[model samples]
Target: MKNRIRDLRTAKGMTQEDLAEIIGVSRQTINAIEKEKFDPSLPTAFKMAQLFELPIEQIFLFEI
Candidate 1:
């Protein structure tokens, strides 16, 4: 999976820790997700979408 999480977070002036707290996740989890080393769960993804004010598809790219 590819995501624009890092870009969005930085654009919003949010540190990983800040975003993590808002999304109820650990900083490491946010880091992992931003690095594309881990994929977020559905609920987590939804939270991100809501926070970023974007659709999940806009934040995350699914490749077949």
Candidate 2:
């Protein structure tokens, strides 16, 4: 999964820890997501989309 999490977070003036706290995840999880090392769960993805005010597709780009 290629995501715009870091870009969005920074654009919103949020740090990874701040975003994790807001979305009920860990900072490490946010880091992993930003690094594209792990894919988030459906619920987590929903939380991120809601927090970022973007559609899931906009946050996480699926490449085939």
lDDT of 2 by residue, 1-64 (tens): 8999999999999999899999998999999999999999999999999998999999999999
Off by over 4 Å in 2: none
Best by TM-score: 1
Q: Find the candidate with the highest lDDT and give its number.
A: 1
Error of 1 at 1 (Å): 0.2
Candidate 1 — what's its lDDT?
Answer: 0.98
Model 1 agreement with the true structure over 1-64: per-residue lDDT tens digits: 9999999999999999999999999999999999999999999999999999999999999998
Assess every candidate by TM-score.
0.98, 0.97
Return the clash pairs for model 2, or none. none
Report the lDDT of model 2 for residue 3. 96
Q: Indicate the residue-level lDDT of 53 in model 2.
A: 90
Measured on C-alpha atoms, candidate 2 has an lDDT of 0.96
lDDT of 1 at 5: 99
